[model samples]
Target: MASRRKTAIRLPRKYAKDEVIEVKTRIIHPNHNGRMAYKDQGYIAEYYVWKIEIFYGDESIITVSASAALSQNPYFTFMLRATHSAPLRVVWVDTQGDQYTESVDVVV
Candidate 1:
């Protein structure tokens, strides 16, 4: 199994109903592009977060496809309409098939 990495998520704990809310997220990753050669080893394999998905309850709020072009520990921000209090789930999937998930409770 892959080791778990650090992740951060920021959002208002409470919001008005039907109001647009801002969400900020980030994950710690090496984001190797498989272009650099190691001292003893050959070129490092490409490994990065290929997809990121956010869900408000059961509905998908946002989905993104990332590549080596993104910087290390990529950051993302987006807006969503808060319709009710629920759990906001964030998932990041890497090229190695590892998945990281974090959840925050939102109140309205």
Candidate 2:
């Protein structure tokens, strides 16, 4: 994967009881496909978020499959239907066992 220039996220400050919430997220990383080398070593260790799971109140809302061509620090924007107040949790797992997580509070 290409390197992501920026890795971050943004969400609405508030939402209605049954409003559709927009969630945006980006990550800064070099999704090395484990086929390249920097200087030393025959190869560079693999690092990438192979899967991302987004959830609301423990219920999964969206899941995306990523690839190296997806670019480094991939950014994604999506919407989720929220019926009440809950916490949104995001979890990312890379091939190297690196785990990243984020959460947001949704108010209805």
Q: Model 2 over residues 1-108: C-alpha lDDT tens digits?
A: 356434455778877777787889876667887778768858876777789888889788789878655677777889877787788787777787887887777777
Q: What TM-scores do the predictions have?
A: 0.87, 0.78
Provide the clash count, candidate 2: 7
* Tens-digit per-residue lDDT, 1-108, candidate 1: 256548878997767989998999999988898887988889888999889999999988788997777788888999988888899999999999999998887888
Residue 92 lDDT in model 1? 93
* lDDT to native, each model: 0.87, 0.76
- TM value for model 1: 0.87
- lDDT of the structure predicted as candidate 2: 0.76
lDDT (Cα, 0-100) at 107 in candidate 1 = 83
Model 1, global lDDT: 0.87
